[model samples]
Target: MDIDGRKLKILEAIIRDYIETGDPVGSRTISKKYDLGVSSATIRNEMADLEELGLIVQPHTSAGRIPSDKGYRLYVDGMMQRTHIEPEIEEIILKMIKDRVNRIDTLVEETAKLIAMLTNCATIASTPSITQVRIKHLQLVPIDEHSVACVIVTDTNSVKNHIIPTPKAIDFNICNALTHILNESIKGSTLSQISLDKIRVSIEEKMKEYGTIAGSVLEAIDKTLHQEDMPDIYIRGANNILDFEEFNNKEKARELFKVLEEKPYLLQVLDHTPPNTITIRIGEENILTPMKDCSVVTTSYSIGEHTIGNIGIIGPTRMDYGQVVSVLEYVSHHITNMLREMNDS
Candidate 1:
């Protein structure tokens, strides 16, 4: 059957009511609460039409109806226009970024926490993939006869340290010279852009005897970047999911908690979402089975062509779709701008 304007309005009303009350909405509730200008009989007929269209469903025990996943998909797609975040919320987020966030890791963590606090939903933010960052400074400090400590600072100001064993008779002063040479060659270049073999050959030509030592230290830097290249994911408000009635079941809640606590699974889930778009996944559409009853709104931020980070919020399928989406869209855009400004500065 074709859905007329009346049926569409009724479907929208059902979705709104269920989102507000978390209960099945009866025709009487719709007739009394919404000024649809239709009588109870007309509203009941239209509701039946909605059920026939699979937009709404009736529980076995209740005469009232609730929105199905398809119903919510429709409501968010068209019925609701994009709404701006409130001024108070925008101000809070802006102030937080201006004052508290400096490093990329700290930015992701703070953003996740703020989202969790503002939306009261479980939130996640991923740090920029290490492969996309450029080396800002590479320092080699002597650590006795056998080892030297290699410190790599990225353009984002993230620091990583590694230790490499060297020849027992190696020149301790070799640290200072190699540090200058490595910086000249690799600084301002991304890890992926660095050619370790070419660098080794080139360094050996410049400082023949200590060339191998430079090569050894260079390998340590490479290993450090590759070993920990995975984006560090920050998650917050995991327990917030428990407050929702949908997660009241012990087994269901436990499964979601496990996914949140496991960084690998969360990383995979967020990584698969397309970048630079606001995506909404509802019910069975979720890749995680434990999330079948929940919905996720996600978006990503980037620096130039490289995607720097991703953020998402997880809540019950009956979430306030308009509000969640507005906050997510605004926050992710703000983060993208902030990162570019930081990178340039």
Candidate 2:
């Protein structure tokens, strides 16, 4: 249906009012609140036209109008005003980073929680995976005569530890020598390219007498490398979904809460979002069964050239899209910058 400029303005006003007050917006309310320079009757006629175009719907025969899914799509794609982050909010985010500079995981978790708190919505953050990381250092520290601890540090500066059993007790000096050999052989190689054969060859050539120890160390490294196939997802403020009056329906709210608890489902949802782009999924547009009554705004965060994970905020369908989109944009940009800095340092 074709919409003239006047009808579009009426639709915009109605949507804005409904979003702000969570109530049906009448033609008289728009005429009095916004100086459209038009009579109530003219505005009503325009609203009728917009309703006929499926942009707005009347919840009741005598009630005012609410923006439909098509209307929200138009507003988000064309009419919604873009908002800027406040300087004070930026300062708060910077302070959060400076306080947790030494702990990468803590920084990401806290940042996600803080965003959720600030925006009064559920926030989800995907921790960087191990596959995208290059091996920075690997060490095999002897724990006892029968076991050695494998410590793998990635290019992202995250460290993982594993223990491997040895056939016999080895002295500290011998363990140190074995560690040197392992590092020299595997230090510069990607985890995927490192193999047991290369490690066996290195041990046969250098540490022949302690080949058993070398075998155990290689096994531990293989496990650590494979661990990257599964990524971690962190969610905060899931209970906040209950606070919205829109979700007061017990059955619908329960289903949504159940979906949020499923990490794999959340991961799939986050993964579907485009890289470095802010995507907004409105009600009925969400593919997940339980999320039909909600809206999700998400963007992927990157470390250098590699897009690692996504961060998003979710709320009721009547969410403040303008504010939420602005906040999400700022958060995604800062998160990417922070991850890059962490990698560099």
Candidate 3:
């Protein structure tokens, strides 16, 4: 595809104007606002040629032109100026990670929501499955007469608490013994193999008086360990999607609203993207029906050697590619680094 330098410049001007004003652009507007140094008639001729080449399109017979999907693709892939995140923004993001250091899932969710709010775009983040999480340590705290709290620490340094009620009161010594026994047996095993029956047998053999306590603890561990399959999905600023003037149509707005609420649809969208790379899916390239008018930029975050989750930005096809891409890149890198530190800790 041979795009002349002048034609590329004209297309870039139209894209920039449309993105700024949310209005179909005309040669007069471009010639007036931009230093194209060309007459409106000459610019119009170039726009017509750009349109013929599928780089721009006229929304109506007399309306101004908007960049076609092809034009936006070219601008994003080849012409749009790249942006770097400001130092202040980087500081804020790092501070957020530090504040939520103990909670990796919360860290991911808050980071995505913050970025979405800052950028005025919908943000989605997926953390790695807890099923892949290995247990690092387990501590049992006595909560009350009949209940004990099971605190599980994973290899990722995430702690989860589960409270289990026993049939009767168990003293502190028994609780400590049970905790030691359970940790010794299940610490290195995957969650699925931490069978309650096996735990009961070990407890009965060790201390008959604490059999009931052991059983309850085993139940709690089973519940806590299996909890990893449900990965968290955070969507922030979904309402921002409606702010785009292009989605003023009631039907289009409703369709997008519904899709955003559907977790499976968002996961499918993220899953389609390759791991660990920023993917820019422009309008019509999106597989989802409602997302056809939107664009998505996504990249995965990892913990050391494993990809743990993905984070992405969602906006209109006219989204500022430079800003969105930079934000996603910075956020993804920061999240990965935070996760690695968390695992190390």
Candidate 4:
């Protein structure tokens, strides 16, 4: 049967009702609650068509219909609207983000807590991978004629410094000149983009006459970039998953908690989320087997043009889509703005 405007409206009502009550939606309930002028009998016939079309499913012969994954997909794609967040909640998030935005760990922690409080769902946040971050500038401060301090700042505002002994007695003036030349060559390249061979060739070519400090500079850059303050995953409200009836089965709850506890699993989910927009992974759409019964809403937060990391909400598929979407969007935008302000300051 064709899903015309009428059929779409009926499908939408069923999904919305199921989301609100966490119960199967019947034709009588739809007829009573919605403004559809059709009789209950007429609506029941349409629901049958929707089930036949694989948009909804009947859990039992006597039970009403609940939206199938396909039905929820359609509803989310078209019918769902992000509700306006309360002004007070928005203010609370903005103030907190501005206060903690200077420190990444603090920001991630606060962000996870705020989102969990607002949405009442488990939250996960990841810091930017330093290797993936592009360099903004590299400065060298002369400690003496024999050693210099190399400070590299990434576009994400990550700073790393290393002190290295010069191969020769390079003076402060030479250190400044080398710093300028190094910045010109690799200023915008990510640490991963700066290959050892490429740096050796570039530096040697530029400073061939000055007895190149290429090897020492490359060593310092590598050490600074690989100093191994690994990107941390901050999770808040993992127990919130227990609040859903769908996770009432002990084994199911344990499985989800295991997924949450594993660093690799959390990393996979963060890596899969698209940057700069809200991505909703519903039920079977989730890549992890244990998360098949769960839904995840994710979006990336950025300091500027570069995306630093992602934040996600994990809950049962019956979770409130509109509210979660609004909260994530608000938090992501607020964090981005605060980060930019921090950078500017």
Candidate 1: tens digits of C-alpha lDDT, residues 51-108? 9888889976788999999998888888976667788989999887766456777878
- Candidate 2: residue 199 lDDT (0-100): 75
Tell me the whole-model lDDT of each prediction, alpha carbons only: 0.84, 0.80, 0.83, 0.84
- Local accuracy of candidate 3 as per-residue lDDT tens digits, 1-345: 898888999999999988888889998898899887889999999988999999899898875999999999999889988788789988998899788857778887898889898778999988666665667788888889988887888776677778888887877787788888888887855566566788799899999877876776777667766764667788998888878988889999899888889888888877765657889999899998898999998888876656767888899999988888888888788777877777676
Candidate 2 lDDT for residue 72: 90
Residue 107 of model 1, lDDT score:
77
Task: Give the TM-scores of the predictions, in the order they appear.
Answer: 0.94, 0.90, 0.82, 0.81
> For candidate 2, lDDT tens digit of each residue in 1-345?
567888888888988898888888998899899999999999988888888888899988765989898899888988887677789998998788767645556766887898888778899888767775667787777888788787877655667788878887877788778878777776755666677888788887787887876776677668756866566778898888888888889999989988888988888778878878999988889999899888898888777777766888889877788888888788778777876787687
Could you say which candidate leads in TM-score?
1
Q: Which prediction has more favorable lDDT, 2 or 4?
A: 4
Please identify model 2 stretches exceeding 4 Å from their true place: 181-190, 193-196
| Regions of candidate 4 where Cα sits further than 4 Å from its true position | 136-153, 159-189, 193-217, 220-224, 227-230
Residue 281's lDDT in candidate 1: 90
Tell me the tens digit of each residue's lDDT in model 4 across 28-127: 9998999999999999999988999999999878659988888888878888988898888878988898777766768898899889988879999998
Candidate 2 C-alpha error for residue 341, in Å: 2.9
Q: Of the candidates numbered 1 and 3, which has the greater TM-score value?
A: 1
Q: How close is candidate 4 to the true structure, as a TM-score?
A: 0.81
